[model samples]
Target chain A: MKIEGVVFKAGEVPKTLFKIVSGTVRETRNKTYHDLGHGDYVALLEYLLEEPIQENIVATEETEIIEVSLEDEYLNIIKRIIELRKVIFESSIDLEDIVLDDFNFEKVDIDKYLEQVESLLTLSAGDLPDDRDEALRVIESLDDDKIITKVNLVRSFIEKFPEEEEGARLLIETAAKVYIVLNDRYVAKSLLKKLLLHYSDIPKFCYEAIKTLEGIYRDEGNIIWRRYNKIAKILEVKLRGND
Target chain B: METIEFEPGQEIIKEGEEAQYIYMLKSGKIKVQLGLYEFVISDNNPEVFGLEALVGEKYTETCTTVENSKLICCNSSEFMEIYGKTEVSKKALESFMRRTAKVLGWI
Candidate 1:
């Protein structure tokens, strides 16, 4: 059915499951989390769960929804997911909006950010939110130049936060990943080599850096793997010598 | 193909998220599910999944790691290229026929 107006209210359940085929659906009742566009599900979960629809589904424009019915097997599966979602929400911080906002920092002060993260980690106990996950959430969030800028800050963060060493290591690893995802392997390679030499003293730092390098070069064939293997060999020897 | 590691409870694919890479389980088990139904532990099956967006398949299921897991992933185009190979195609066909023949009592 084509919808130019509201289909269901917050308290009512729809008779049939409808999937957005074209145009947008405004999901409001809580907060506007995000707009549901084409190929998005509507009322399927609520209907499957036999619960009242919790959101106001209104078409932002001319919207087409094809009525859909799942196989009994599939309907059973969706019911379990609704239950699982509640269980997950109870255990972890609601990460539903993690991908909604792209990590857009026009001015990123590395030190101030670390301080904020440190305080947050103190309260939450080691569950610091790393910006790398944000970058990975949306692959196009950071460009090559932006990632390079972040990598340069990794060393300084490590130096400043000896107590929060893991966060620093994560930053460096994330920076390298940005370059890898962008196919700027040269920058990623150089960053990994420098980490081996510069942060070789910290065992956890070296381990994470090497793993990030491995992940980045995982697509590269045997020859490149051998080259990366050589770097690891040297890093191990240097680290042992320092010990 | 590339190998990626995931921690327990990490959602590799969400219910409505665009399917990017087709994945093959290398090690460890993953729970694949939709709202109420969960597929059995995917330890025995070596089938590739997360291809619905590439093809025209509707996915209500989300796949999450059960433990520290390793998976090999390839883009749709890359997987198709390898899957389209004559040797791979022949082996797959033979495997299917063998299973069908056994079921039919013609083995």
Candidate 2:
């Protein structure tokens, strides 16, 4: 059967091995995570070691995975792969100077630390509500640059309080910045539409959303025109004369 | 291809509509209903639906808005043709089917 999947996310390490009968594999690794997609096999080392596995394997998109067991034949393949992997990892490591040093434990700065804690509490207590209000105020203020900062602040606040309507609104405004940034049009369009539905009465949000919708259509390439037109019709109805 | 926006409680694609397009959720949340089962796919987990239609098949379920939503629509035939040409797309489709089958205990 055919398979379709994307590397939605990765865990600390890979825990599965997939032998590609056919197709290609793409592996992406970033500071926070590592992703493996399609034809890549996972966990060859663990299978060879017969050790407890420590990584996660999740399909990036809808995927077809044939689970391979550690049978004798598969074990031989795993052994070869493990040796190759060891060689690769070892060759990549660089030797560095090591200094032998004695460890000393320092006395804790109890009072100073307490004072710092109090200072942090005071700062957060004062700044949180102010930041939240400023985020809302900036949305109302409609200054484009302020709107962007408000969006970031709103997202930060939402990370702490996802149910906040004000924060959600700020996210919508931030989403609109897609038109200005030219990155991830789909995400921007989605955010604008969400704002109109959730914050329809917010005044000017609907207008801004419609304007962004138009921008999406104008900017989309011809190959995507058919999809753009359908979205445009909806925006036309939603924005009406607001745009 | 067309785009559709739905408010919470709105139905974007009915259960039995001739699946003509592949849907990409650009934002918000959508709920897919199949008989008694329901799952919500949102911006954080945007979904591509009506893919079966790409194989010239009927839609397996109805997709509606769980919250306000934005959807990008692409002609099923066009999308299938484009997707068919890509090795990644084929692998993704196969992986998805196998996983789904495993989850449902069908394989």
Candidate 3:
């Protein structure tokens, strides 16, 4: 006879070790018991413990069965599988805990790297007085990963030369983009307003601001639509005056 | 600064009244109803309503106390002043509006 499946309830006793000579067999906990196919074996743990089984075993489908008394080789295999399962379960829990902790950073020399970059930019400029071309080159050379980093650098450069309108405008545009990337819509809106205040004649900046406002409205309609409506009203008033 | 208590079925904020204050629930339950939609809150979940009206909307979802409830109310003018200055508050408002528009198919 062949064993097909095994089942066990919490408090019930188990006996009789059955080997699957053919087909599939399944052994599941009573609470989650469903069905098992053919060639399934059961009772290795019960035989090892030399105690009554704590679950009911049944054939899920048409099957045959043979009961084998306790044996040594079968007990070793079951013990090995249980030990491996325990390690796998514990490692999975440890991995999840580690991921939740957010503990992944490798220290590197950011200051040194910045110094090297600044030196490269200075050397590339030769004897030319720091002009817009040089400033543009420096801005272009900056890594575009985080808008904040680029904005901060440009801001520091602007602070050194307060009267540099071109540098200030460029920095403001970069900062606005950074705010957008960071999802800081209010800051982006405020920055755009400030940009317009300084350079109202720049149609490109106005168009950019309008586009940014459109995105902000799309992302956060309830918060941005009122502001959009106000801006739109102002734009309309200006257009009507031109006519 | 005073704690206002309301019994069950009391209207905390009507639909069309000028939104003069924002209420933060300190205890008990409240329900926010917009047309056929309703959401209930109890315990420590602080619900912010009447904010839509603060931006000159002239109306807000109706709020009613679902049980014996305590609330701390802040005047809307003062709240708006502080809220407008806050970057986080602005972002939150934007996110809320954007999601609402998407749901309503106006975006």
Candidate 4:
């Protein structure tokens, strides 16, 4: 392909996928420019999402690209990698060091993460409510000044009805805020983690937890935020899968 | 808020320019450049960019399209007035954090 030649232009309905072999292609979307080099798939996201190609994909030099198939094993791996990247991107987590060959989905330990989430779900909540109704009454009877008492009652409610997702959600959502007010971030962070992990299906809670965690980690410093940000991205993707 | 479309290689915002709007990716991809640092923002997730507008500062970064793109542009002051407490602010904060992380070579 000659320089400035269009491989695919924005607004074109994607029909085929191409894999870059050599040279470079520049993808220009609106005013942004990104170079796609060897091994990068062209129109892959658009094709996969069934959306019109949204970028002007042009050869930036004498580029060689080969048409690829969805069934090709290597191409499938690429697809999976791109899909994973898409998930992380959607979750607002960018892994800048993702070398394709070094990437392994199995190594992500999603199962282990899932296992931890499951363990949390089944862990004994210190004491079960005498009954659901009693837990409800206590949960409903909160005074604005008694932050500690509110935390305890919230914790008790969760312990009392770990299985009650809807009821538990209401209290769990507010629990983190209260914990923050009490300056018990360790507990608050853990509670938010569990809340997000257990309630991955609920988008609102995931957003809240991620946002809160982002704030806490940001306050902690760049290095800590860097580490937690990756975990947050993973958690976000896990939640995306649930969605 | 209004949706705006751009062609490939179009400058959405320029460094040292007046920052009029905070932009969110409605669709497509954008390349952001700050000094020697650069990164791409795509619609894989709805991301708020051009955050300098939120602080009433001149744009410190340049944003351009790497492809045809659609963005939700909100007048900075208006956005602050209406969406200060909304998820948009959270997304903006997250974007700011990510940029800081990039500056620190942590992203």
Residue A139, model 3: Cα distance from true site in angstroms? 1.5
Angstrom error at residue A185, model 4: 1.8
Write down the TM-score of every candidate.
0.28, 0.29, 0.29, 0.31
Candidate 1: tens digits of C-alpha lDDT, residues A54-74: 667788899998776543223
Instruction: State the lDDT of candidate 3 residue by residue for A147-224, as single tens digits.
Output: 544544554455455465665467457755756566656545544554454455654555456555545544552333
Given candidate 1, what's the lDDT at residue A235?
56
Q: Which is the leading candidate under TM-score?
A: 4
Instruction: Judging by lDDT against the true structure, name the best candidate.
Output: 4
Residue A64's C-alpha lDDT in candidate 4? 89
lDDT of 4 by residue, A97-123 (tens): 423221112343433443354355453
Candidate 4 lDDT by residue in tens digits, B2-100 = 899999999999977877888888899999876446889898977877766754556767899999999988886777677665766645654654554
Query: Model 2: per-residue lDDT, tens digit, B52-87?
Result: 555454555578888888887887566655654454
**Against the true chain A, what TM-score does chain A of candidate 2 give?**
0.29
Which has the greatest DockQ? 1
- Cα misplacement distance, residue A196 of candidate 3 (Å): 4.2
DockQ of 2: 0.02
lDDT of 4 at A28: 50
Model 1: how far residue B106 lies from native, Å: 53
